[model samples]
Target chain A: MRLLLVEDTQDLAVVLLKHLRQSGHTVDHAPTLKLAGGLWSSEKDAYDLIILDIELPDGLGTSLLKEVRASDVAVGVLVLTARSQIEDKVYLLDVGADDYLTKPFSLDELDARLRAVKRRHISKPVVTQSVGPLSYDPTNRTVWIGSDQLQLRSQELKLFESLIDSNGWSASKEYLFDRLYGLDQDASANAIEVHVSRLRGKLVDHGLEIEAVRGYGYRLRYRLDE
Target chain B: MNDLWSIRRRLFASWFLMLILVSVVVYWSANVVVERSLREGQDRNLQAVAQVILDSAVKIDTVIEFELPYQAFEVLAYSAPERIYYAVSVDTQHLSGYRDLPRPEASVNAFGALYRGEPTRFYVGSKPIFPGSTERLRVVVGQTETSYQTESTTIAVWIAVAVLVAFTLLALWAEFSLRHALKPVIEIENDLGSRAAGDFTPIIRQVPSEVARLVQTLNRTFDKHRGLLEENRAFIAQATHQIKTPIAAILTRAELLEKEVEERSRDSVKDLIVRARYASKLATQVLLRATITYREIVGVREQFDLTTLVSSVLRTMDPSAEIKEVGLTLLSPEDTPVVLDGDRIAIREAITCLIDNAIEYTPALSDIEIEVYETDNEACVSVMDRGPGFTIDIAQLSGFDTSKKDPSHVGLGLAIIERVAKSHGGRLTISSREGGGSQCVLSFAVS
Candidate 1:
């Protein structure tokens, strides 16, 4: 993925740029809003995501974000700010930001958010995604292990889709339930547990596994050797 | 504070007292004028009868003889129903008519005396029997004064009563006018009474000139308060930005260094990252506390459902809880929405703090249960964690206290929860769960 990072603080910017590069993302760093605007105009269509800092030395990064959005560029914008006030977060999101991260965020979390923002903003229509011997087609809603389609109930398929959307991050049980039953449905509290247990059994043989994060929920990942 | 002596009551009392005084003065003056005139009419009648008798006298060789007029006495009878007496005399010598009638003094023409067991008025007249004659014949007439006295009293009382009724009606009209004049002030009071807290909008309603100054001062005060709150909000936002940016930079740097450093030195680098993260959290919490306190001072309140608020807080805390591998569960009455009236932001922060604390303390793969319930008069959100329960007496913990068991745990979370609960006329309680772990309940009054 290609990203544009607009931040003024040099100490933080250097580490973030290094971490982002190590995570296999191609990044261009700009320490001021003026430089960021220049980069955005020059390579506006080349970037998949823009990591913006709200406070910059020259001017606010929001101005550059607005410019990028106004040009109708299909680039994901993830706002990074030290302002954790709910109003600021809401305002940033309301102003066309795909996602936001408060300062002092974990590198792993930042990478996850970047992927999530890219998925939301820039649509790359892939037919199938694979994990080792397992392959799933999102368009057809089918899973195959060595050319044999895995059988799953409608609820189980929905749970699988929710976990897949998490992008290797854990999806909470409440979130999974909401995805499965929707807002107005009447279902048992343990309905998610039953579906997850059944899905776990089918995925284990395909070099893919569903791991229950005890206090959280479930994450779908490649199976590790025991 | 003297509620009984309101402006209306005071004005009415003063007017009432003045009216009574004027009524008494008017009645007394009217009585005096009426009695004097009536008495004068009686005296004229008496003098007329006396003059006729004096004119009827015939002088025979220096001796005077007079004939009493019957018609003149009858005229006095026609004026009012009262007894009358008359006498004709020369130097105290009785001529005709009642011999026992009281004579006037030698120099006085009219007088009052008791006659026939009743108060009476007497009149006297005298003239010489012939021209320049020194010997004068005197005539005296008397009548009882009961009828004229009664007539004067009746007239004075009726006049006084009429004046009293008219003044009383005037007083009532004045009271009605006063209330109508003050209608705007009452409207202002009602407008203020119905306002929601934190609303500092100035009163712009039209008012009478008499009350305009008061309303203007009130509007100025509202403007001043609105400006101060706005400044406070801006300051909190600025301080959050100024304080946390560098901390984030430091934490990110420490995290990076932890990976590059040798295994033997990795623990120290990890500690550096933890401390930086803690500092960042502390700064955020402190700013949040200030914001909540400011809102409390302004008394911002709204109605919201407890279940919905808890659900949102759980969602917000999900990522952090996920990183810790802690499972979150919500238990609430199905189809029932527990509603409470309070500062929604403050309450949301409080619930977030509790869940955050639970996630921090509970081990990985443990579960945190959040329940929303309502009692008879309170709406409660309780967070239960399958972690080591409180070791010390919960009552000893202050908002800023550092936990003895966990050095890294500052008690700001509990402090925030306590502050929110108290501001809502609610309470925060920490108790051991039935089987294990800890339960923290934050409850607010339903009102």
Candidate 2:
């Protein structure tokens, strides 16, 4: 994929460029607004995705986001900036940016977001998979424990959903609270643990077990009948 | 706005003009009165002589001769110079000094009208030094035209002096009166200059009635404005802070969802929930400090180890620090108290804004330094960025006043930090360092 990176910092740009190129993206970089504006205004078909840094020499990335969205060009945008405050994030997202990353973010996260954005534009397989006796239903909010139906509470359902969503990856407790309960709700770390433990017990009661990844989060698994 | 011409000047200017007109009228009137009195006395003396001498002459003419009181004649002539014209056409030419009198039209009487080409006065029927019954004799008593000239000159000088004195006195009075009257306005101007933008201390002074009422009204208005601004600022801050709770929940849930999907499947749905969360935090940090009350801004000194706080921020941003290859360095003294009276949260946010700004702009290979140094009475925290130095037009980054789109003067993170510093009784100093970078300093009085 061809990507346009509108970042002011050369060092960060280089790091991003290297990481993105390794992840199979051809990247073009512009440090100033004039350069970025010239590149976009001149040709609309040169790039598939545009990554913006909010603080540019000539203009904010938002203007470019607005301009690009206004035109007939169907390019995707991923905004990268150091403004980590929640409000700034919301503003950028509201400005029609496809994705936003606060500064001091890892290339891995950026790669994840880029992949997510690319999958949106391209034709890809249906995002769910079933391995052996365990099956996951991301849309219906249901999970099968060895072909046996298991009942889970809304929170428990969300808890299992979070684990199933991660596939086999670990998620931080803070990350889970937000996914299960909204950010405004006062949910303690113990609450997340309680919910996760209960959901795991239900799966086990239906002949299944979930693996707890330490320092990260949880994963679901079940034994295949021989 | 244009109607606000200085009241003091307008009042005094009109007063001075009125004084000039009044003085001119009064002095002219006084001069006329003196002239009238002098003219009356002259008229009386001339009339007395005319009564005695003319009656005697009338009887003497009838007797073919009479005693001529030449002394009385001279007295009458001196008293009524240029006041009377006497013509005696007696065949005897009996008037003493008649030989030397030299027959000529004499201009007599102080009150004269121009007749023919000579200035003269005529008091007919009432005789002067002559009598007319059956005898045809006309006697004229007169003085030269130069006598009245002297009187007119003297009167003019007196009137000029009086008018000048009146003008000077009027000018002085106007000045003094205006000075006393405008004292309140001057005090108000001085108070406005010394007091800060948000400070609304009213001036209470005994002013003249009109000015007193005006100043009182203005003070009331200013007080009301101060309250309104304070309320608005606090409301915005509170709102900004309050909205974050829900936004926080949205971001958290999104992050949890993002974690669930695998590399192959994570590409579905919206990708901006975390960014939305960050925006909420930024808004709270920016707006909260702007709304704090001014009364809460005094004498806030507390001690905290700032180095530890920076280290915590480093940890918070650690995930990016490793990936970006950007260095975060803290240059502070070990085991030192960064004593300061201020909102710690605000200060932290200010620092976060600056450092975050630096980290955003600086290249991956460049370095960022968070410097801490304390003076005897002050503590300074500077965030220096080795990025492209601060531009000259950074002030123009926000507040597009001429814009039709209503940018609403939204400032950058740096601007928010500047506001926070000012609200805390401190200052945020920004300068471009030598070479290519920007430096920002938050100065606080030692606590």
Candidate achieving the largest DockQ: 1
**Cα misplacement distance, residue A66 of candidate 1 (Å):** 1.4
Write the residue-wise lDDT of candidate 1 on B1-447 in tens digits: 797798878888899899989899979987998889999998998889888888898889866777778899899899999898887888767777788877556668988888778989998888876789787888888889999999998888988999999988988898889889979988998989876455576788889898999999998898798779768777977887887888888888887788889999999988887777777777777777767766775667888888988886765555566555466778785468998998887898889888988998886556788999999999999999988887655455445756554545766778888878877888889899887889999999886
Tens digits of per-residue lDDT, candidate 2, B298-346, equal 2233456665556555544533443343556677755665666655555
Q: Clash number for every model?
A: 5, 49
Report the number of the highest-TM-score candidate.
Answer: 1
Per-prediction TM-score of chain B? 0.66, 0.67
Q: Which lDDT tens digits does candidate 1 get at residues A1-226?
A: 7889998999889999998898888999999998999999999899989999998988888898788789977889999988877657657866888778888777756765665565456333346786557667785566666655665545567888888778564699999989987998777677787678767867887767888899988888775644
Per-candidate TM vs. native? 0.67, 0.50
Best-matching candidate per lDDT: 1
At residue A196, give the lDDT of candidate 2: 66
